[model samples]
Target: MPLLNNENKIPCYIQNQLIHDKDIKSIVFVNSHLPADETLLVKSITLVKRITTVSVVNNFTKELNLNSVDISHIFIFLDNINDIPSASSAIANQEVFSLNNPKYYFLFIKPTDNSRDEIKNILDQVWKCHELWKYVLVFCMETEWLRIVSYNPFKQLLVEFQSDCNNTTMFSNMLKNVNGYRIKTIFFYTLKSSKMENGKCRGNDCEVMETFFNYINATNEEVVLNVTEDLLYPVSQDYIKQDRADVMFNNMFLYIELYKYSAFAFAHSNVYAVVPRASTLTFLTNIIFMFTPIVWIGIGIIPLIYYHLLSIFDNYAIGKHHVRGILISKYVYALIFTCIFQSMIITTLTSPKYRKNIETLHDLFESNLSIYGVKDWMYMFHREVAIRYKPWNNTSITSALNNLTLDGAYIVGEYWLNLFLKNKTRIGGTYNDYYYKIKEAVGTGLLTYYTRRNSPYREIIYKITLLRNMAGLDKEFGYREINFTKALKSKSLTLIHLQSSFVFLSVGWILSTLVFSIEVITNIILQHIKTK
Candidate 1:
């Protein structure tokens, strides 16, 4: 028998420690990294578990034969399989266990703090053999453990762990004594003020730990807090409330500044909880009032003077022949009237102030306006109206109009407005007409165009009007009642014919107006010469 030498510091237990148990169910092989001898050791241990082991291969599988044994579990140990032959051969051996119907778990062991490039290379190999079941890669460094858990085909897997020592204690004790806390403590201690300077507690080293402990104690309720390396110092619950209050204050100030100038804001602040709606006409009128001084200076004064001068010149040349008379006749009257009419039309059509007053019928469909129209119209154009259209063939235009009147549908500019009003009384007439009621609602600003709240083209309208005024186009023309009537009839005919009626009507109106004016002028001149 060999004598045990106690003087040489060799004990029976120390000698036995070097020997690994062959019957061990789970084996943890410790080494600086996987070596050739270690691979043999792993293979021998796996053989006892009745699993075949194959060497890494470059091109072909080098199969190892083992007596058929019942394998229930398998754990693959690997570092980096840089050698293609060894890796391929090892995977080929793992395939045998699969045929043996063993439940397998592959464990890839790597030294921790791997760079992104190294991690990518490792993942490339792992993904290639992902068909194998139950795989886990563990990166072990003294400071941190990077674990890549399994992901199924359809779902993504995310692993979140708490960084706080107190919160993490419930899961794993290993994290509680991590090196992060030691590094943080060391950093705080090295601060310049961390050392006392006049018997006063100096630096941030005062009661940070105590305060943190208190915070942990306060959170008695179960709450999952996700931690990263950056979140080493946990925030206190009291500080979170202060942060929320600060955010609220900032938002309130921002909104208040936004609403400071307009009547909309004034009403919201002082008059009522919400602003009232107004008719298109009334809304535009108020907008004109808001910028009254500018209007008076820009177009009102100069246009009035110009119109008066033109009228004086036309009166002086009233007796001229047809061509000269046509050129000079009614020049002043036309100019003045044109100035006023054009001003109104331009303001109404292009101004941002007026846009809010009258929205397109489509706008009503899209808004919260309780309108009803045909389903086809709703499908095609109701998005612009902001209204809901209900399809009902049995519903007549008269009945629909009546319902709208009763419900006080403020604005009804739909395609069927004329058809709906054909049999209804005028606004002031009997039958409690819906159109009048709607008009009243609009006047009171109860139901108005949704677009009126914010003028989408306000700036563009202002710019265009400014341009028109600068170009001296601010003039109005009086409505020619007889000619307008004829024109209206011709326009109606064009609508009925749906052909080139507009061109025919335009030519006819111009010819008719010239002939009528010439006849009148010739008769007046003959009468004057006969009297003389």
Candidate 2:
């Protein structure tokens, strides 16, 4: 038996019996005396015996890799009362080595070190591993009676800081109480990327982000937020000027002095960041059907006009009873019908597929109209749009709007673009070119919130986002376009449709006038000859 003291009063059999009763798999003896060939009666259990000194105990983690090895039981035998303080300090520092990870711990100490201060210090180190003592079995070996006490680590939380926070004013404003978990704030603003670490980002602040960050650092919080690391990706190169300046001028007197000089002049104008909304502009199928009526009306009018003209000719000159007149009229009617059908068929075959107008991304690509994007950035996030438009960065959307170039198409969010287009009366266009959308939306990124690996508040935030999305808040936020139920009315004719009508009128008038003039000239000549 490893002697608890010089007397060695505790029997090896009793210790083995207690250990066997508990069914402990592995045991680690620290600063305990045992023979080189010592074996416990329980052959199934594994034993690691170490007679470590104070110096070795302090640097014990170096000798043993706790992550790779498993020790179910830990027996720390305090040799001297003075060694108690050093051992406690060593255990506290190296708590990661054998603390909450073990399934069971058997700590054998002398009854003399059971004073209030000594016991408190020893237990304090044990609790550092988070909610200890559930698996711990403490025994104070006394001469007459053994003193055993059970401690529960979770009964009272030791104030080793309840929460953590990064020093930012926005974070302070956003996270409210976080389900009653007190945040122990430490100002250290760090980021994995130039990613926006917030769910609801507005300019320079984010309420969702602050709340999430605070909730993440809290000790008792166990919520898992379904969020990505990068909530918003600013395509601009100079997004992190604030974070960068903070890092560079962190200890600089001159930088602080310069900030004082320039802060008021810029004010908050340049401090906030704005991300453009992402969504596809879909083609309105309803609008395309609106033009169907006009096409039918135009085709239907051809036969009607032909019959009306034949009736007019019969009333003016040729009687229906005359065989020549009847044959001529039949020939003319056949020719007219043939001409109309041929023209309709040829035009339909030659022209490209019918699109209501330039509305969808596919329509934009197919149209002869040039695509205009931002001058500073390429709006190539969506692959198909990027490939077709190939985004011209030389001219901006603002400039394009200002110019109101009739030959080009501009890509922008629906709400703002619609508003702009509604007010754009200066541009002389008969078509409502403003209300257009791409049918397939390019899903490049999503706006999401992040939490710590295990946070209790995660599910709450997730549900909030789901409800917001379901309510179509994206439309409210201008990420989605207005749902236009009404289709385009093609009753309003364009130049192409009127061209055929004008040609028929022009030819009829010209031919009638020429025939009348020829008849009048012949009559005058005959009368002149008779007078001569």
Candidate 3:
């Protein structure tokens, strides 16, 4: 009751004196109007409050060499205590003074703007001193909005201004986009180490490359197959030697290229690439037709006719009128007639409209002794007879043909019939050498065909060969020998041989009669000239 007297000056002066005392550890200012200097003094006293505690009083006195006559906890309050420069000075002093007692903790009350810079400076000091930052905590108060923000160097603080914010949906969307996005492309990188290895697969463990064809077919994704490099060679390998080892690799590469091309075409259009089998009789027959001397003979005849015509004209221009002119005219007529007859024979033999009778290779194999003028007759014999003799699944083209030849069929073809010979050598020991003999047996015009019409797969086989040749891939197998005997035995040729032989003979006889008449007329003209 006595303290309620109107004279309040006594308690305020006493509190100010207590705050100024050097023994005070804690300062709490409770006046409604705190003077700026007094508020600064309160903050300074609070910064060193722990030093005044009883347990460390003697230690603090000893370290600082200060007299500890009295100790007390003091408190202070100021409307804008943080606005005073003494607050920052006190914080800096506390940071340096507390260095000796590393375990000591301090609490700072700061305005929001000063809080960030203060915490940053403290963290910089801790980092420079190599001190543990885990214990440092800063509290900042926004008095205007009544909001409190707390910061720690070692911890992340998330303060949402909104009370009922939903972060889960935002976080989920961010994660979904970040984790589930991918770019579309198939990349094949050729490494250096493998490229330098001789006889190595350039694929570099990439035999099974990914293709968009399957993906698009299955998933309907608008995918495209793009090949960056059409050909990749081993870095330091000799191309010629590596070719053999690279055969399979090359095959795979070609397969991919072809697949891509085919897929592209199929996607846009309806076309597809076709692969050919070597064992089909139609394939052999096509080889025979392509290699036939008749075709070559037909090709050679044009130049021969031109040469003959040029010779005749040259003789006429040189004024060798009596001797050279008459002789050249007769020769020209005979040659022309012969060419027409031969052309008719070839045309009738090769005509596709008149289908051949013999359908199978067996028919040719069993035929009576017949002459063959083909270059690589071994392949024909093998296809017809020897392949059937010791046939095995997965047999190579050369092996099947060799087996056919070993079964007593004669093969006549070019000496360098390398394709048939090389394959035969690969499969047959004794008969491999027989290719040399077969090659030596090639003859001119013994018998030949315009085409092999009897084989059912003729069209497909020809298409395959043509495509391969067009792509320059046919050299891989080398040239095949032509077997005219088997070719003529084809059903198409058999029908032609039976039905058109008479017409050919008749034409030939008529050409011979004409030749004789020309000779007779030349003789009569010579006699008349001699009489003149």
Candidate 4:
């Protein structure tokens, strides 16, 4: 047995009892008693063992920070009392590795140096910074006793554990239970993605959050979760900075983030909007659009004009004019033209045409119609929409629903998109193009949950995200345009569904402009000729 001291027979409880399960990331640090056989360092008891001197501890720590796994189970043994002060700095530096990782540490001092004041001094030197112990579990071994310091994440406090059993049994149990952390009071800010209804926070985003927090809130009967939709802080970063919030339930990922906290992601959503789909053609234009300009002159104009001229000639200068009334049949042309016109009218009414959808951001902005976006979405992605090009910024949630009968478009975020569509379906009871979601997404990244850099709850939140995603719990509440795309494909017709008609109207407008130009030129030429 590795001696705790020259005469003590404690038997190194960890070296003998630890059952390595292939996942325990164990590391051992010894300052003296070098063994020539390197294989002992590679055994199951010590996956990573290093021999360190006082002068080289800092270098070793830096190397470990760069190469070690995010979480660590470390056992550090010091041979000399003077080594504590230097080891304090090196051990404290290990806490700086990752914002989301946790560390379980066991520190054993020489039997002569294992005083309570010595442990207190080490705490002061290593954890002088406030709350650095949040993600670490510290175990200090004594000859006859074990001292441990743990942190409660929900309550946001360091707790010294209390045990009724003897040190040996408690020490063994502590090793077995070191894998989990305790819970306390938790503050969740739901302002970023949820709306307040009768003092209850609710929305699409809140529902997704409930998939995790609801499970967590019920995980322990003692857990206290204070979920609030307070708007006192305008942004999520402010809530974290003010210490009023422990985590942001949902937050937009901005290009320039304000917090240094770890972003714990729960939902991956993209922005979608219910924009207006405008018609490209009109009723009268649809008729003209069915036939080319040359066909128009040949089928109707030239035939009528030629017949009229021949009639005048036959009445006067008298060609025999099919003399015996062996007829020319004008009714034949009438029947044919009438049948064509009737066919076109029926086709145009049923299958109206509209402008190609404003699917891309460039096209939506360039469409030149007024656009409105939710105030929160506008503020979150303000980098892309900084300039208020139009005075169409929505000041309220009710504004999105108002677009159902209105002409303009509204940008609905992932959180509000589903609710907005539901309200639209309820109002119209059928499909309408006035409030339709564009097929493409507008945001740059996924929405995430934000926690403090030293937050002990981050690991739990990560696990919840993993398991919830694996079980498809939150996916039911995620952003979906599948149904909306189906709505657009529905055969039901409405006044707003006149897309093909608008295309016809545009073509008619072009032809009208061409005719107007010719008439103006001819009038100008006639005036000049008469003046001369």
Candidate 5:
């Protein structure tokens, strides 16, 4: 409803019209200060009675000033075929055309009193501007001769098609006879798969493909794209990097970047473990002394030998009635107690704290847990967290979270991670606790089809995208609500049960081995004294 101009002021009288009128639109009339009689054609059109004027100065070198005006539609009047090129050039020089809004052009021309040769000249000029100013409507001053211009709906289109080789040449073959600007393709090439084979284009074989063979030649088909630079296909970059042609060809109008709630998910509202350097070293040292193959074998053998000695003591005490048998039994019981005490100490040191919870970046930075994430996500994570972590590769992030050596959470985009959550069993966590949304969002990205700079089809694509969004067609293309607070109700039983069991088993093994060593040393001393 608001109009922008060089002087950032809105007229008071128009304010009511803007408020009262349910529909609001902006139309601009571009001209060279023509006479009142010549402007009669534009005035006759009731739809654009309140058009804002952007008059071109007499000095042809200087461009027209359209500063601060938000123009949605432009009306250009061509008095004659001779004025076509100059008028088109002046319209091109305006800054309003470069905005992120839709633009429409209406061409109003005066009837020429010239021969057929002059009419052909007029058509030539119109065709020249057709490629530049798309979505154009041509009007004649004399209504009787207006039928002379045969209007084909497809005449103003410039299509840059994208499709997989599987679609073959069907799309192009369908639009062969459609009158319009030339259509180009945006193809991608990788080392393993390309649009070309053995220095020849694959699309050159089919009838429709043959028509565009030269345009999409082998050299042209092979292109390196930087999709991540725009964050357009953040979740689907892996697919686009390899086979985006198929994705674009199937989806028509309004290519949307999915807003996924899971992208911001990090572990929160749960207790996180922080493994210190000292505890890791101490734990590893205990494991080494306890799990040695020889020591482990002795633990099993020594337990059997102790049972045999108890039987011998029972027989010796009954036969000889000796008090020495009771003394030996007491000594073995003390050794078992010593082993049990050592195992308990190891378990206590390794037990992680589960009381403190992390909810913000400040808490995460202050905590001792090391952050680990995928290699490709390093740039995005580095922008948020201070700690540097070695990038993980070809591994599931949830599976890696089980490692007590790392922080329990990681950063992943919505596409890959969300798919992973939907299909895989919750091995390391429950559905409710899969991911926690961070307090601050790094940023959001828009997904757009990659095309050549100054592509003629850009305007047409923009219009299609806008129309689709208005009609709610983007929902069909995998759009979903991003509820950050929502979580799954069920929890995984295996993950919770195994986390503590692994630690207990490790501590028990070390304790039994220490007891076995004492039994071997005691036996050696008894033999030495008997030999003496």
Candidate 6:
């Protein structure tokens, strides 16, 4: 596509810089009617460079279809600065530019529109649509000496340079050399030693902040949050902003997911619940559960097999009548026991007859259990059932934590779920004895953090998050898998499986009875002799 004319050839240096990042597969050139000279330049660049490009002509006549276009880097050539506002508004509605990333933009302004006020005006017009002019480079040349400017993520720092070499080397150098930018992060405390949690932060927050500052190199500005849900929560975006915090531990733990922050996803969170252990069934129910009907029916078939065996043994064993009877009885007993044992083992191991707890979304809503969790956690994940139950107060929270409220299930993140188990065990001296997470997850929970917009440390934090997530954020962030793990085959072991133990116990009883008889007979004989 002939975009620019032959008279004005694009510098090779710019072409090399534009294709620097290997991540960018295709470049989008959005321009309107070009002059004869510029059109020839575009033709030469397009053919010689061999860089993949998507040409979208904006003649101000009709809407362009950018829906299919996967635009990463944008080359916008603007002749008139006044046309920028309308162009920005039009592009903002399109999916290609909806995110307002501010990066991936290289503005080629005409010399006439290159002024301090014009640049400020252009920024003002786009301000409502965009947050910060991050990674944006604007350039206009007057003969050989090049005039270029770069803006950082905050958009507060304006770096202008007049150099012969028009490359992005300055931008890279500026990013590293930039200093005096501090980040103040306010995080919610998971556990509080004092009754009142508001005054100062302690416990888990201290440990978390230590690891946080190590990666981010930021100071902690502690903020305590108390919600009606009575569950521990991270700080709100607005609250942290009001407190003048440069960064924050937002969208973490149980906070409602906000999509406003720049894309730096760190965690895969799900709405897991602390459900009552389903093994706590009644005696009658337990007895019924023990008989997990195997493929070959244990009860009915075993008796018939024993009968057949007894008949076979009677005929097969060649001995005296009493001896044959004893041998047949013993053989029948052993055969019947073995058949029952095999069936029960297979049945119980394959499918343990279980008392159904809340395992699915349908099961959860239908269940009578009062769900206790963060308000947003309940509302977002289980709105149907969440409406039925009220948020837990402090009193209810204490009781629920101690396994006092058996009917109530607490919804929590997999990370916090482990913490809950640890806390319970610390107090009660039991690990997973009282509560267990259900098989079905309510929702996926993300362990993402939202920094105060335009915070300098935001980029560093994002990079750290990327590395941590790639290495498994769940384990990297100290989430214990042992807490949530359940062994189905072994855990499903029930009372009826102990029948063999009872058989041995019965044999011990018979032996003890024989010993008692021998002792009594010996004592009686001794007494009779003494009397005589």
The candidate that achieves the highest TM-score relative to the unseen native structure: 6
lDDT of 3 at 347: 46
Per-candidate TM-scores read 0.19, 0.30, 0.17, 0.47, 0.34, 0.51
lDDT of 6 by residue, 318-370 (tens): 32343344344445556656676666544443332232443465555545566
Q: How far is candidate 4 from the true structure (C-alpha RMSD, Å)?
A: 12.7
**True-structure Cα RMSD, model 3:** 32.4
Highest lDDT model number? 6
Worst window of 10 by summed lDDT in candidate 4 = 49-58
Q: How close is candidate 4 to the true structure, as a TM-score?
A: 0.47
RMSD of model 2 against the true structure: 17.3
Per-model lDDT = 0.31, 0.36, 0.30, 0.44, 0.37, 0.50
The residue-by-residue lDDT of candidate 2 on 1-532, one tens digit each, is 3453424333342244334444343445565554532343122223212311111121343445444233444555554444444554454344334322343333454445446455556655554422233333334453444444433333333212111111111101112332343322111122211123464233211333354455434332222223331221121111122211111100101122122111111000000001121112322332233234665586567557656655655554422233343344445545664565455444332221333232244434454445555422232234655554535543344544545443355554333333354444455642245333443332222233322121223344544444434653444342434233332222322335545544554355445444544545666787799999
* Poorest stretch of ten by lDDT in candidate 1: 265-274
Better of 5 and 6 by TM-score: 6
By lDDT, the better pick of 2 and 5 is 5
Question: What clash count goes with each model?
Answer: 32, 13, 22, 13, 2, 15
Prediction 6 TM-score vs. true: 0.51
How do all the candidates rank in terms of lDDT, highest first?
Answer: 6, 4, 5, 2, 1, 3
lDDT over C-alpha atoms for residue 280 of model 6? 39
**Cα error, candidate 6, residue 81 (Å):** 5.1
Error of 1 at 305 (Å): 99
Q: Give stretches of model 5 more than 4 Å off.
A: 1-24, 35-72, 77-95, 98-130, 133-182, 189-441, 450-532
